[model samples]
Target chain A: MIPNTMKLFVGILRPEKFQLILASGIKYFAPPKNYDDIEIPERQRLRIYDKVPLYPSNLKPPKMQKRLRYMRGPELLHNKLQLKQYGVMATGGGRLRHEHFEMVRLQVARRLDMKRMFAIWRVDPPWQPVTKKGQGQRMGGGKGAIDHYVTPVKAGRIIFEVSGKCEYKEVYDMLRIIAERLPFKAIPVSQDIMEKMAADEKWQEENNLNKYTLKYIIQNNMGGCHRFISKYDHKWYGKYV
Target chain B: MSFIKKGLLQSPVPLMVAKRFRGKINVQKPRKPHFEKQLLIDISKPYYGPPKNSLPEITLCENINKKSYKREIDNPFERILAKECLDWFNTSKMVVFLHVNSISMEDKTPVFAALKKNDMHLRTYGKKIVSMATKGTRYEVINQLFTSHQNIIFGQPENAGKMFKILRKAPQLVVMGGIVEDRLISKNDLVEYSKLPSLDIVRSQLCSVLQSAGSCLVGQLNQNQQMLVSHLEKHIEIQNNPTNSDNLDTNAKSES
Candidate 1:
């Protein structure tokens, strides 16, 4: 049987829907939403971030290796939210510069209703030093001078979170903008959306009809594919880059 | 002489000489200045810049991702109170909104007592409760009056005159407006309505006015028959006694 709402649309188009109206069931309208539980925190805006990490004047800024592992495979830590409400989650691996941090900060500050909603950074500020040589210089003597800084992010890593009395719709646009502008693929997700995605992924895995799935193939190392793929592919079953 | 003349016109010579001497540096060692420690306040200021990409417009279909569920989060107490207030709206013939200033319990008690004595109730409800009670009802227009502390006096329309009398004694409760007999009226209109006489008295007065017109018509209709009877009786009296005819004739002349 058709819902009563459908007959309303049909009636609008036909204007003579007495027969259709007689066929439909009774309509019960949805009640309004209640926001009794949502408590706005003391502060309801993105916190200010330092341009660079604090370093003592006496000690020179420390240098480190490329550590390509940091940006490969899915993030094992900082993947879940500290204050779960809504946030931008990275879908691919990449590095975020200080400029990206400023972009996210400014966009959140501009759009967030400070009285009802607040946003916070989940990823650290730009702290990894990136080395670079002079523009026209030949091969660098020893290691090149440390130039700028960046924050390495991997798949499933939450870049920032917004919480408080606001619904996901209030911050969706701002989070989506930040996610799109990031170096790698990312998506805006609320806590419910994240949980649903996880449940769907598990359901798909459990209900797979195919005998030869990617996880199965990777785990069994069928056709000797281990030689061609990197250790990350073996570890994550080729799910994340 | 030329130098003296220039000095006289432009500058005082003795003062210029003093200025040149004053330019000499101090030869004595300067005293040590006191020092104070500086406090460094680290304020993490927000950075604003040109966004690399523009934000997409808010689309209507965005809520499709969210799962809808029935919310049963209404407060039970508020729900009951709202229902009770709705009953007040339905049953009462008049609802007068009064603005309550800052009044202590002692000052407020007498006003409440007076209203209670006259079969009127003075009630105060929160803005939320009032809005919930008035929502989608004929009494919804009174929702705007709930901006500040407000009291509602509910009673019959006839008792409005008595209500106004009691309210006049209490300076705290100022009648803003009210709904009387289902019609919304202002404070002045309410006062004017209260000044009107009771319904029964007005009805009786109208009945007397209506009956007087028919009574006057009946009196006019019987006047001709009554005059004929009186004239015949006087003629009989004159026929029985001829000596009394002169006295009767004088009476008839007066009558004519």
Candidate 2:
């Protein structure tokens, strides 16, 4: 006789309870088809939405001119240092469209898993809409309706920053592909490369090898005019003093 | 007595019994009441919610507000190119700036393609140059400018040779070095340098030569052992046969 603790029951009392209990059990008999067994047709699997209504273009209001140039000097140096991973920097300036941004974002997201790997949009998306006049329309009437929008990218501006668990070699090809497809010329740059460039620039400046200085230009071009100028002369007075 | 009563009685007796417990109740102390003033601050609602007019207005320039206006005349676009050029100068071992000023668009296409191809090569070599430039006390940038092309084809020794050949074919494109050594080389000298075997090829050749020399020494060492083995076999054969040994001794005496 089997002990009570060791005894096992083989019969099923309730059919519903049998399924609930034996759901995970190994099946000796063929299993019945459930709702999940039904096949979905390929055509009906994906649904497409109708055209979306267009909204009025929200253009950035014209404001007082601060600086004439879009981006000058090394303003993005700190930004580069902060996100010191493999990224793409625009070598030439141009307008980037909304579709371009979406395509790039989709391509990157598809290739790299968003959880472990991601990209930061260095440039803002196209917010200012540009309008075009209809063909053969009179020149003097009202302004044309908004056609499309674009984000004006300046040279030396970083368009995108891709970071996370990825090596430069692994990311370089993707970045190069993105760079080639971009409207403006762009180049793949890594943290080490940028750091090296910055260090080289600093070294050049320290050793006075940097020929861009005003003093160097003056010395080379004006033949040391500082010798003729009096030490007591007013600072504002031209080099003639 | 019943069996249950007998079992209970048979069990061990209780060790002790508890007596009635007693305690004194003390009066609680009176609680002290305290009053404090409360201050409220009216937090301003966010400007984005209803009534968009609450948002600050940005002043527009009269000229800019006009339908069509020209941008300011400034060369901001050139700055990036200048910076890139500076980087090339700083990083490259050699920079051969081809004077495409006179070269036609048709002629320039091939050159651009070649440059594009060379850029990939440069990237491969970029790491070595970067490391070399970043390390130690001396000016690595200057050293790199003189020695490394960063694997890029444009300033690479081989590319320089190819460029020399191209220059020979098309005399119009003048090559100028952005960062050249003080001691200048003629066109022929540059062509010669380019014709010379690359570092990899030279290293491989040296390895092969060493391998051959090692193999030759091993062969020489083995030759003496082979001669001794043959002599030992002859001596063993002479000792194994008395008649052959006697014939061998007669033959030796006759030969002497």
Candidate 3:
């Protein structure tokens, strides 16, 4: 059925799934004709990566996602004003394409967010060791990194993760199942805006944090775009956007 | 269980990001379908004496015909960059280490094609690759590719069943990773499980192999893992594997 301009909400999915979550109606494990098969509807992919409150000591990422949802939605929506959703994925690196499936985007991001949502699911990278010579303090170890469990990306929001051997859909479905089961709060967004954010690149640019001034989702101006980087490191703090 | 303005329950697993509305947003161009393929990223460990090769790594471009090159995208690109330096590695007459991940839900063909292209050796850990922990059929593709290689080692204890499928081709692919260390960290369960840091895991795996084929502390592994490795059939045996036992014992001694 052709869709109407219905304001919508969104979320990410968990990576693992129960044996029989879907009765089989939902699409699963279909081969793609090419890379174009993936898409994160311009609107649905309306997320701006920023380093807000890194952790939830007093403020957490969920709360941050919620607050940021409110802050960016209306303007981002350009007053069409719909809902938006944010899902996090635990990709050590950010590389999902601009056009992966909307479902996959939500699912993958939410799967990564699972570590942040629930501490039990917190799976740290298996090889990053602390070099600071301490029990807990690390070169990358900060209460923010641990408490937030996820680093916000600046420009990586465009790159869909292609790492490892999992198929895009398969990986997405697993996250969808998890999102279905996650207990984390769903921060409501303007469905209208969330629906159109990506397509409106010009408007996106208008709202887009100035490249030199504002740091973006996992965006790194340092030499090249690095992961887990921060505009917080820059001498011109909050001045670039 | 904190509820303030709305009725949002904070469970261990939150399902709030639900989209009861599947309304079709204006999709620009329809997404092109893609399948997962197996890729054998063969990196001959740096053991062939000094650094004879000019380039340390070779990354296959997204397009195969293109000469594989490398540029720091500010972080580790494509997860495993070892594939970039395959040329220098294979010809070096060195021990190649392939860190493999397989998921039952993926299509593992591309990875296989890449590995076969390099004419690389293969091995397994005799364990199951975690389908849940991975992204796509790509995991399965890698699984099938190496298992069918001329030399295969079943590194994953869980995937021991897949060992024969590989043994039928390759003589013996060296097997290591958590499988050798006896810890299987599935991505599915990693949401909350303990894993060595990514850097530490990478360092240990590479260092373990490079540092004198000796026993090493394998990725935050524990006593239980040690026992499991000791019992992996080949590690034991009073006769058929005496030489193997001697080396393993020496390594185990160092880890302790």
The model with the greater lDDT, 1 or 3, is: 1
lDDT measured at residue B178 in model 1 versus the true structure, 0 to 100: 93
DockQ of 3: 0.01
For every model in order, the TM-score on chain A comes to 0.82, 0.54, 0.20
How big is the RMSD of model 2? 42.0
All candidates: TM-score: 0.45, 0.30, 0.14
**In candidate 1 chain B, what residue range of length 10 has the lowest lDDT sum?**
B36-45
Per-residue lDDT tens digits of candidate 3, residues B1-256? 3454246654355767775433322111222322210010011111233444554445423366777676523223322322322322223332223433432213334334434445533432222222211235223333432332122322323233233244224323223322223233332232222233444686888986877444344444566776787777544465676787789899999999
Best by lDDT: 1
Docking class of predicted structure 1: incorrect
Task: Choose the strongest candidate by TM-score.
Answer: 1
Residue A210 of model 1: what lDDT?
A: 54
Question: What is the C-alpha lDDT profile of model 3 across A1-241, one tens digit per residue?
Answer: 4334332211113334333322222223435344433333323222433322234588433322211211111121122221122223321122122223334445555554331121111111111111123566555543333222232222212122222222334344454464343222122222333456446755655553334433332244443433322233243232211
Q: Model 2 misses residue B227 by how many Å?
A: 76
Report chain B TM per candidate. Answer: 0.59, 0.38, 0.16
Give Cα-based local distance difference scores for all models: 0.77, 0.53, 0.32
Compute DockQ for each candidate against the true complex: 0.01, 0.01, 0.01
* Candidate 3 residue-wise lDDT at A156: 13
